[model samples]
Target chain A: MVKNKIKTVACLLLTLFFLGGCKKTFNQPQSNPEAVFNELWGFMDKHYPMFAIKEIDWDKTYAQYKNRVKPGMVDAELFSLLNQLLFTLKDGHVTLMSATDTATYLGFYKNYPLNFNLANIKNNYLFNDFKKAGPVMYKIVSNVAYIYYASFAQNISDAELDIFFNDIKATKGLIIDVRNNTGGNPANAEKFFSRLINQKTLVKYEVIKNGPGRNDFFEPKPFYISPNGQTYAKPIILLTNRLCFSTCNDFALYISLLPNAQIMGNPTGGGAGLPYNYILANGWKLQYSATYTLSPKMRNIENGIQPNRTINFEPQDENNGKDIILETAFNTLSLE
Target chain B: MIKYYSNKTVFLKIGLSLVCWLAVVNNACAQTLNPDLYKWTFTLGLGLNSNSVIDKNFSQLPYSGNGLGLSGSITYQGRLIQQQLNLTYGMATLQNKYYNSLYATYFTANYSPLFCLNNASNSAFKILAGPQIAMQYARRNYSGFVNNNSSFEFSTSLATSIEISYSIIPIGLVLKNKIAVPVFSYMQQPAFGFATFFANSGSQNSVKNSSDFLVPNKFYRIINNFTIDKQLAPRHKILLSYNLDFYKINTIREVKSIHNNLIVAYSYLL
Candidate 1:
């Protein structure tokens, strides 16, 4: 009985020591809320290099927020306030953080976009003697059209895109290239795909599994037909490379399921989810994947979407502007 | 009677000191080392550049220029089943004399399965695989009578990198050699919508034609180092180390290569 008592005492003491050490490691000096607010306000007032905005009273804004902060306020509350202040600057470069929020922030880059090559005439218009380089543009006999969209973020207006689509619709067949697209807003992709897809069809399903401040399970969201209506009834070929990612990959995977579409080129860049952002203390923002996606065949698309017919691009061909991948797509369309 | 009381008080003080010492010793002994379990590690490092020149001849464009740089990193490591995993965060900033600056920040999570070479020595190797989030910021200002244009271009790039690291040492002075390959790099053109600015001035888009913000057609690094550590007294250790790093930035067409920097760093690891 005496020995047992000694063992229990030893265990209790060890636990206490471990807990104390952990507390010391994580404990930071309590920040004086008033001092922090004053410092932030002063930095903005004195060092704001740009005198762009003259209307708002910086001092009043600082005074209002300074008094609202309390000593016991959690890190989340501080982070949210910092984010609000940063957003006021309208600079996309600035961000804030706490240690706990970094994981989500790191995760945002993982599933952000699909990879594709982009070709914008306007981009060329800005430069004289501009030659179309990169894998996104191809000219095959001028009869078959090739277009590489590196991202959906291009400034192509809806009307301008419609006209471009109409121009391509006259070709024998169209090669929609999304070789290195990393992804952007799904709405942008929907605008392009809506013109090709005839009937309402399910493209991809998404489920948010885990993330900061997220629920345990979320139902899958589906990609549906766009209201803009269909444009192309002819056979369409999609050229993809390992760089194809995110929404671009999803569009290819979903459209491949259609009987009228065929996917060629390399396997896609693997990003099959959505990332949600959370503001943290220290004005750092965290983003993480709040979801996972599966193709219609119930296969996880994170490893990448495999092409129906695989065609590899030689590095030498890419340098010489000899687009072997586009040639394959053109031949496939012509054969059809 | 007074002397006896003082002695008693002294004895009590000695007893309390003994108790505290025993508690510390007991806790250390109870902390078992589980080889199968995960361990967290933090690292800090400083780097010096060997070569700093942005070779623009590969693209047939004007020189982008280069500058000296400093870098640092912190990492956490663990084992999940047969796989060894590491999560690292790193940053570097470089400044050229011509008022051009480059900043890079990245976070990478990697996993590699332990391939036991010889069971007798317990030394194993693995190929790391995972994703890296990288952001590069570049800004340049051209002033003085030497240059005609004076402007600043800022590019925000989001890229994913695939990395592979080999653990040459496992126990005391663990060394890992890693190489990262950027697969997808998407950058917002800093010159986007600036065409109107140039159009108004009839400058003919000179800024957009400059290859200052071209995609780093290729970027990779190699790190070789040994970490030696021994406890000097209690929780303190005299950490001494040497590290060699190599960085190569390739051209967009993979036709010609330029911009190579090698660094050797000596640091006291805490």
Candidate 2:
């Protein structure tokens, strides 16, 4: 009995010596202009994926912007200055989402032809005949399935992909139009392209920023596109425009790699960079890419991916009420 | 290796102190001590908690938020040794209002030994020290065009606590105060941003380093708690408590969180 009691005492003492112990801090941060600007600028300097690739001198960019940032600047002026900094990166994925406004870089299409018009397509091609599933719109034209995917972010359910493809399986070929599809989920890009390839294909390589230093990046890791559970052998004509970016850019590049695929129209707005957002000390939010994405050829897609056959739909063709991109895709696939 | 050696030294020193105390109690002829006379008490509590996140990843000063949480503990009180052993578990979920659509949840399990200054049934002062392991998971859900951003972290802390209790049996009122501080911790935080974690077949590189622990100057947690018990019978009581917890770390970036809680509980002593 005494031995048992001593053992119990020792065990209790030992247990006592070994024993132990994230959060919503809902309080608003003190808002300040200069501090917020520094947070935004510092984040990009350290993590933005395109500094070296774009030949941007960030320190010099900081010197120029910091001169414009005043401590007493209001929310609008601060937001304008910060948005201007992202605009300098010329990446569409670089966005500032705030209560009053959302900012994005549209320089990709500012100097280029739109290369796509919804009104023109609906009047000439779709003609109230297009079927909608998720972010995909489809219509049959001259024995071809013309499917328009408006955004890469829009998810296509397995059932939707199955039904949509099954409905159009008898067509002679496919025209996948992604013009004006700015971007969305990159996973969707891989998934949508996976439906075209029967085997696993390496679509893109990714390099992640590890440290705050401009050049600190892990070695490129290959991102693969696994077969998306469906197979099609018909030639696919993937259309593009300058506004197509990020995941959109990725999707166009992946399709362009397929043996039976052809890419036509303007080069995409390069947004292959993956953007993440952070709130400033003043609760203003800033968005910028931290992950650098590259094409299968190891070319940085931030400068946009060039199409195999760059075709501009002439304004005269649109004035005559014609969908020139669609007409070109139909004519090209009709020949195949 | 340094942590292993220093913690071992701490165990040895405390073990020696306990053995000496046992020796003194055993030699006291006027008092007889029995280990079988120890009593166990269990309490279950639900709390309304308010908190703030100070992660540099979020904002300069993370906004304050509120949450509901549950806590329960099993305590063994030694009448002869004038000591107690407590094992506790607690969890809470909080939302960041300023950064709308973001949620953070925390889970912690703690074991601590209390050395009473007086007899267990009549003690007013106690000292406590122990180790705690904790984990946190946070999510910033879909906002505008971006969706499903999340993060997870794990850490271990060495905590020391001081507790005081006052009881007036005739008035059926009992009050207790405890303050605990974690002097050091080793923590692991994800290197890449949550948005970079792709939703489909997303790949991540996980690297383990003692960098947070090696820095030595980065992390801390302080907890203050107050409890009041109103007894209706010898075996049953109503308990109310307020807990204030504050934590800060600067591993990859500066992150801080604070929680204030008001708890109501039912107590059972056996």
Which candidate should be chosen as best, given TM-score against the real structure?
2
Q: B1-270, model 1: which lDDT tens digit per residue?
A: 454558879899899986775454334322321143334333333333222223221111112232344433433332221233333333344333323333433333333322211221222222333344444333222221111112222222233322222222323332333333344444332221121122111111222322333445544433333234443433233333333222234422111112222333333322
Lowest summed lDDT window (length 10), candidate 1 chain B = B195-204
Name the DockQ score for candidate 1. 0.01
Instruction: Give the CA lDDT, 0 to 100, for residue A137 in model 2.
Output: 84
Q: Each model's DockQ?
A: 0.01, 0.23
- Best candidate per lDDT, number? 2
Cα shift from native, residue A229, model 1 (Å): 3.3
Q: C-alpha displacement of A241 in model 2, angstroms?
A: 0.8
